[model samples]
Target chain A: MRGLFKKRRLLMVVTALSMLVLAACGNSNNNSNPSASPSESSAAPATETASASASESAPIEKITLKALMHSSWLKGGMEAVLKDAVEKTGITLEIEKLPEGTDGDNLIKTRFATNDKPDLLFFYPAVKESDGLGKPEEQFVPQDDQPWMANFNKDVWIDAFASSGTFYAAPYGGSSMAVMIYNKKVFESLNLQIPTTMEEFWALSEAVSKAGKVPVYLSAKDAWTLQIPSLQSGAAQDNLQEITDNAYTNKGTMSDFTAKRQGITFLKDVVDKGYVNKDFLSDTYDNAQKALANGDAAMYPMATWVMTDISTKFPDQVNDIGSFLIPFNDTGKNMAGIFPPSAMYVVKGSKQEAAQKFVNYFESIETQNIYFGSEGGIPTIKGITNTQLTSAELDAQKLADEGKAGPVGVSPSSGIPQYVAGDYPAYLQDVVAGAKTPEQVQEAEQKELVKNAKAKDDPNFK
Target chain B: MLKRQYYRYSMLAPGFCIFLVFFVWPAVSNFFYAFTNLDATFKYTRLVGFDNFISIFEDSGSSIAFKNTFIFTVVTTISKVGLGFLLANFVNIKLRSTNFLRSALFFPVILSPIAVALAFTAIFHPSRGFLNVLLQSVHLDFLMQHWLTNRHIIMYSISFVETWKWTGLTVILFLAALQTIPKELTEAAKIDGATSWEQKRHIIFPLILPVVNTNIIISLIGGLKVFDIVYALTGGGPGNASNVINTMVYKSFSQGRNGEATAASLLLFVFILVLVSITNKYLNKDNRG
Candidate 1:
């Protein structure tokens, strides 16, 4: 009986080992097949023939590239537009729409880790920063430091993105930073003008509250949204990039001490004064968006994308939607900032020649126009213009032109460390809940910055 | 007889093989990965000597998550077990319409957690929610505080939802255990001139101790690994007030800190193992006594 039991245990162990090996093999198989798709593999033969003819001249071969991109990029049949462009150039294209969260990042990471990378990778700035070093500076570095980083204009950094030096992905769509979307009917009903100053904004919020409507519909449940007004406060607003840079590099004189205090104060005041729903923190982004659509709240701080999203989501109420930049310092400037150029990069170990050709084709003015026209993305190419933009888009452009716009100070994952983004939201939410003072929030933020700096500097620390 | 046993074992081999492949192997691999610096970016990783385990203690997020997880587990376990037992006893009494009452009690268990959480969110809404509206109707306006956002109250709010969802399962388990108790013991206690409460204390309670122990272990284990309901509801925030071990692991992994996330998972596994073992030993001893 003892011998029989021992034999059975050995069999169990063998079966377990075999299963693991099989599972690993199965994963590897799944990874490789998609890269070696029929169209892409077929293009390889024509490229080899072209290479043979130009042994002395190294001719650039016409090759197709497969790209994994975000669903946002594939809006309004943009993939089909790209497909048509690729066909015209004798280059085949295969694009896969990625799902949200770690699934997309993991898919890309898995491909790279397994040496089965795509020809062109559509890198989302959000996912890159999400998983990396917690600071914004470290988050901005492009994956593999691709060559296209050098071609982008540095001055656009003030309008769109944080870093002036590094470019990983090319910027596509430009969004207004920290704009408040108010119901036009509510403004008309209350006889209130669009408030441009901090004091006026608060007064307006108060009046809206007194009128028995939720003053601001903040989806505080997703902590990120709660920090928008606080992080964009007059003080933090004055030297947004500088503070972000300082926080990342652990250098530079911090500025806007009062502004940071005021920002936190405003957030706290809004919550304490009953301008926001008490259950705001428990609400989802979708719920908050729906609330705005249903006219449940007078205003919500969102990006320019909300205009397009609102128009698409609620066509009937789209006419009532209007936006103005959140008056963080009462500057009366309608433009907050521009996100850095979104672009594609070729992985390091990729078949470089084909990848480069694809990149050149993708960045061409014609391709840019197609992408812009299809997705309403602002093309990065110098001369490309989008003619079919909505009224909100036109207003946003005017704001950018008037020097009212600024770059995204910190992204969730990539441009700066998340501790900056992550901690600020909670502090603001506490202020809303009447738990913390604005001064306390600012002090706490500075302490967190110091803590993050210590952690980044210490290699021994996690 | 030996040949027949061998044939029966051979027939079970296919299922055993599948179990080994899907569950046993991955679990063993997860155990191994916990000891390495196996990040998402790197293909090859070196075996780091307890660095991940050491970090778990040092990180504030992990510590908070551990404490929150323990609190949630202990609170939910005791409430569900104790309340469920009382409920079960009441429902198990002779009744003309027992089946309908039992079904009504078990209804919450059948509802999807997301649906239940959404319903509760509506109920807990400060200005417009059902709970506050009811409070105001009854002239208790002072009690209406922000239920989901308040850090002090959020944990309990989450626990209430969990208890609401799971109390039914506990009740049913107890009811089943109650039915198995020999009627002779209860009758003997009654004949000895014991009161209803006394009879329950000595006879029914002692008889159901094993079942109570089993329910407590199950509920405690389930509570320790609670993820979906909390994830759908609080998402561990208004700050990190409601964050549990699984949510922390998710956030860490989402942030691309795979090594840290694995470490958190490993620590949670170790905690569950120790907790379940202690409970098992204590229960066995209690039953014997």
Candidate 2:
């Protein structure tokens, strides 16, 4: 009986060892497929382009470039552009979608850390350096010599993506500005004009509140939306970049910048005055859009992306939405804060060429029109006019033409810590909850800025 | 004889290899990472000793997470085990629909945590939630509360959801253990002039002490490692009111502070180990007595 048991155990051990070897082989095969396919496909495209030159009539293999995009970006006419690229260039894009916000940002970093980088990825290059990918110069393929780069709008690319005169990313879509989108019907009902100064804005708020409607819909629950009032405050500061730079380099504090400081103060003021929704803490950006569309709220201080979202959801109410720059100061000189579009970056990978080709086709005038038609905004490329521009777009563009607009928000390129921009809304939430005063928020922010700067090994912080 | 012994040990080789690779390797690397300043942005990694741990301890965010985690674990653990026992007893009573009732109770456990949290988000909406509407309709207006938004009650609210989803598991476990109790023993007690409550107190409770102890440990571990529910529901928001250690670790990792995030995770591991160990020791003593 003992020998029979031992024989059975020997047979089981041999079977287990064989199964383990098979599993190992299967895993190794699975691991190589992703990295191998990209290179194999990338090689085909290059040779096809070369062979087509040698023989005029030849078929090109459709190359699929892997890309990582936030799930929200698909709504911004990115899918149309992807389909257009495939139709025109025969280069397919296999996109891996991730959740947006902090969750998405961390996943992108993890991908890079694990050396599982996609051919292309979406990120705002202005703040890309301090983010997980490290310095953009080392991480991305420079697009300085690309034909599309020359046709791109110089001001935006230089201000937003270019660091030390080098471009690493191309704008995926047009620019958006942080502006106050108001319901024209609500304004007409209240008999209020578009406010151009802080005093007039407060007057309009009181008027709307008297009518028993929310004057301003503050979506503090989303947290990121809380930064709009403060970001809009940057419009009135002529030396906004300078002030941010000083704070970035540890030479000045956030409280030293008065205009931006007032933005958080305005959030608290609106809540205290009962001008915002009663459930501001519970309200989300989606809920804010509904309130604005239904004329339950007068104004929502948000980026122009809400226009696309609102118009898509409520087409009839689209015409009733009008926008103006946030009059955050009493001086009546508020410029609309210009926000750069989320750009497509070429990660240093085996499929850079195909990614560049897709970017080129995506920037062409015909494809851009499709993007702007569906998701209306200012085209970042030169000589491409969007005929279907919304009233909000025209108003923001008018501010830009009059030299009243400047860059808004702190970016890593400006020497500020990345988390200051990423987590500022959390502090604003505390401010909204009355857990921290604006001054206290600034003090806490300053301390965080120093700690992060030191972590990054910035000499000035030491 | 030597060859037979070798064959016996070789049977464990594959299983041991998988455990070593998947669990042990990552745990060991995480331990090493906790002692370094390794982050997403840094190209080179260097050791910073206990600075990551010290930083986590000093941060206000970590303190909030620790407090919230404590409340969440305790509330969920007690509620799940206690409610599970009652439900198990109720279902164990010979009924025609016992099998159907068991399936209905376990249904919530199979649903996705994210889906459940999202459905609960709408159900807990301040002005429009079904819970509040039902309360108002029943004329219990004073009992209606902001189920998700109130910072003070957010953890408890989340704990309620956790308990609701997982209590069925405990019920199933306790039910299985209860079935093993011989009918003869309970019948003898009944014949000796004992009431149902008396029989339960003397027979069922003592017999199922082991299951109850197991349920507590399972619930305790599950409560500590919770991430998806809290993340999907609140994202640790309305100003970090519902932040737990895992969510805090996620935020730190999001901010590229991998070292601090790993240190926080290590602390959580140690916390779970100590709590489970103490509970194990106490429960074993009870079982022995």
Candidate 3:
């Protein structure tokens, strides 16, 4: 009886295995069909045939490439644009979208360590040269070969990534621009105009406070949010070109960039004057967003991405939202500062032709307009218009075109420390929070920077 | 008999192999990584000897993080175990709606750490949060402050969240232990005119010591590795006021300072290992006695 039962079970297992194999085969067949309609398939084959002919005519054979991207960005539909471009170029792309936090970086690292490196890797634009392997000369190709980085100032973008005159990554999309998003209803109710200068900003903040409303919803608890506005305003106020140049040349100290100190002072003044809530430092991003949306606070310095979040959270107030560049000194620049490009890097050991083609396609104006517009991001490529821009984005774009605005790269305090070990942002937060003076913070940061520089030079030590 | 024994060993082999590969290998690698310069690139790894460790020693932030981590671990561990034991004792007794009370208590433990942190963040907000609003309504505004950002109170605030989340587990464990205690011993003590306090001290406490030790060790290990709550709550911010070891390690890793992160993690592991060993020795001695 036992043997009979076992035979029956064996038969069942074989049937299941056959079904699994059949299912696998079915999936592959479905994947190859690509088109939903017969007409679409018939139309697609002509393009595919032409592409194949072009490939055959070319002396160089096309190579397959793989890329890893963040899942959130992919969910926003940017992956389709990339895939379309790759398919057109006859490059087979194996794209993997990873979750946020350590998982993303860990997956990339694991793949790289196992000699299965992706052809292209999406990296935070702010990743410092020193954070990577050896000097870029020993790790990657020259910047001239990678043309996309040419838009940003060489000192800030190319040279920043270039160690010994080689570039590892091409700058792609920019981070969401930082600006003061205020409720238009609140402004009309308070009979206030948008502040145009730092002094005016403070005065307006005081007026808002006197009116019994939170002037600025600063979440110092989540320090990054607090730092963004400060950094933006500071960049607008400071001669970052000169500062960056000097820092790059090793002729100037990071302390020479005093606008950051001014930024912190502005935050401190806001806190001290009771313009912001007492619990501002303890508030999370969500809490601050809620406070702003629910009318607990009048204004907040947040990225353009907040527009979508606000619209989703408070559909009624979507039209009532207004944005302005965070003004610095009375410089009269309407644009606060543009976010530096978030970059896509080609791995050093990747097939160069395939990686270059992918990057080139990614940087093409059409691709930028299509992908960036759909994803609600400003395209880095100039002269491409995104018809899908919201009113706020259009305003920002107009401001950028009028030369009233400029693209400000990532803050040195955040970016540089990624390569070197130092608590630049944390120290600045302390200064803003009344824990440390600007001078004290600057001195501490300088010491750490010098120590890190020395550590980098220490060949015998490692 | 020999074949049966072989089958038993084979059955256990898969689980043991999994443990070795996933847990043991990573733990061992983390220890080795402490001595290398394995930054974000991971490709640029080089042996840096004790440079990362030396740097950690020199950095004031690291010292503060170490101090905060120890304080958080000790405070949260003790409070969680104590509160959990008390609640367990109360809930374990025969009562109407005991199951409901138990379920309610265990509910927070089942919640995602980030979600709990977010909920607590709202409750603890100084101006608009429910806690402060209640305080204001009761004319106790003076008592309310920025709970998560105030340097003086941030540690306690973080510890409170940890206590809130894990206290239920401790309570359940203690309740299970409490149930197994001899009814006869308590009855005898009561017959001899022992008060509740005296009986608890002599009979109940002694009987539950083993469970207490186990809870302490588990909570200690958990407390030592506390990351998500802090990450989602304050992110060890407002100038490293609430920086813990795990957050520090995370920051290092994010910034591509893999060597420093590994070193910090290794230090944390050693700290936990030493703590566990000490607790184990004490428990074993007590058992022998």
Candidate 4:
């Protein structure tokens, strides 16, 4: 009986150990799949892209696009478009929704590095060196000669992804990068019109400040908030393209970035003069709209996305909110900054003919109409009218139509590896705090750029 | 002898298979991959030897991150373990509400770190936050601060949240250790005319010294390797102000510098290994003594 008991005990131990081993092996398999999902997202089954495609589209040609998209595109009602495309084209979608912010960027890069290439890349086409998603000759191509290019909004496309005479990706929609949205009621009370030049903007802000209200409400605590006015302020440079070109081509240096500091200086001046909200540093993106709604501030430097947020949050103020250009230059065509919309890219060796066919058909006015009905932002496809639009979106759309919407943010492929384009906002934050002048940030950026160039083996370092 | 050896090997096979597949295989592959000049797409990859490791020191931001990580680990470990020990002693006293107090203290540990960090976000909000609002109501407005934004206080604010979330676990650990001490020992200490402090110092402290050592080692390891709380709270910013080695590893990986990220993670692994080894050595020595 004792010997039998000992053997049974050994069997139990082996059984438990085998279970542990199996569990560990299962967890290792889960590592290949990302578990990034926003709160509202449904938990998807862990299905292999190929297997899923084969099973669903077995009766058809099994055209599955393994897609990677940023969370915003998913949350911003891009599903309407994706579902519509699948229904129209019969091409099944295998989607990977990435986490918000730089986490998604890392995941996409990791997927690429691991040779796990998705067929369709639906991401915001950022040209910043760090946001190396849709760089020239990387995973995607220009595909400029495609017939679908004719339908894309020409002005916004040129501003957003086009650099070095190579278009980066297809922009689904675009907006004036820095639309200075304001409470028209406050403007009316102060007898202020939309400022169209540098002098007018400053004077208007000063007048609003004298009226015992915050002239501007910068949600600086949300660091991404500062990029709005800063990027638009760079539009003051008449030769902005030349400077950007020189920077990437190794001919530009820190000296050329001097003009880009004007907005930062302007912001510092406002903050120092007590014209900005005292609680601006603590005011979150969530509360900024509420503040504007309750008349806590007059103007905020925001994008059409903010405009969308405001209308969504406070539906009563849809008509009350108005937007204008950043007006960094008195004479430079009110240079509008347009952000690249979340766009799709076809993998190089993907079933190109089928992919091209799907992409081409998705661009048709009928498909875009169904897409635009649910989606906001300026329509990328020509002739898709944006209904229930705010004055801000309308103004931005007008700029897009006029070919005045300029590019915004650090060029993604500016090749100067050291100086982070995103760090410009941090410098702006310090500038407002009166800790460092814009020149100091520029100096640090210069040193870093030189180091980066040397490190990258760029010939421009000397 | 051969059959007995075969039986022994068979008994070991399951756990070895797990460690071999899950741990050894990936670790070996990762170690090999660390040397490669792996591009964004892995298309044109080659071995680049120690270049990835060299760049670890080459970047200035790396030093700041390492320093912040070290400081955060030390400060939070001390705060959690010290506070946890004090709370454990107080709760161990003969009182009616000691059970309730113990449960209340351990509540935060049971809650998710992300949830705790989110709650701290509201608590630390400079103007409208609970901390500042409470301060203002109490006429202590000067005590209010930009908790997560100001680079100076960002790490402490994050560490405070870290300590708050995990201190309960340490308290519970210490409490369990304290319960093991015989009541007669304390009664004898009291009869000998030993003061409360003296009783605690000589009798209680020495009796729970092993548990104390264990708690310290646990706290140290937990503090050094913390990620979710810091990631959720400050994200190592206002501008890399509260950055740790892990956040830097994340950023490097994001930028498609996989080789550099692997090196950064390896550096963290080495730091953890050294600290844990020292802790183990101390604990083993104490047990023997």
Chain B alone, TM-score of each model?
0.93, 0.96, 0.92, 0.93
Calculate model 1's interface RMSD in Å: 6.2
TM-score, per-candidate, Cα-based: 0.75, 0.93, 0.76, 0.83
Q: Report how far residue A269 has shifted in candidate 3, in Å.
A: 2.0
Local accuracy by lDDT, each model: 0.65, 0.81, 0.69, 0.70
Candidate 4: CAPRI quality band: acceptable
Which pairs in model 4 have colliding backbones? A127-A411, A127-A412, A128-A412, A177-A337
Model 4 TM-score, all chains together:
0.83
* Highest DockQ scorer: 2
lDDT (Cα, tens digit) per residue for candidate 3, span A419-443: 2425666776786678887677767
Deviating ranges (above 4 Å) for candidate 2: A1-42, A49-56, A410-422, B41-44
**Candidate whose lDDT is highest:** 2
Give the per-residue lDDT of model 2 (tens digit) for A289-348.
Answer: 999999999999998777878878888898888888767765567767778888888876
lDDT of 1 at A39: 52
**Candidate DockQ scores, in order:** 0.35, 0.53, 0.37, 0.30
Isolated chain A TM-score, each model: 0.71, 0.90, 0.70, 0.77
Q: Write the per-residue lDDT of candidate 3 for residues B19-69, one digit (tens) a residue.
A: 887799988888888887675665434687898888888877888788888
lDDT of 1 by residue, A1-462 (tens): 897677678767766776787789886765454334435544564466447446745543455667777665556525645676555544666777786444466676666555566656676443343244222242223422434334445454423333333444455444344556677778888998988787888899889888888778878766667655543444235556565556555453233345555555666667677788757776756777777777788888665566556666777786676666667667543344454444465543224355555565565566656766655434445766643455555555666677776554553224444333225666666666666677666655555444433323323223
Position A194, candidate 3: lDDT: 83
Ranking by lDDT: 2, 4, 3, 1
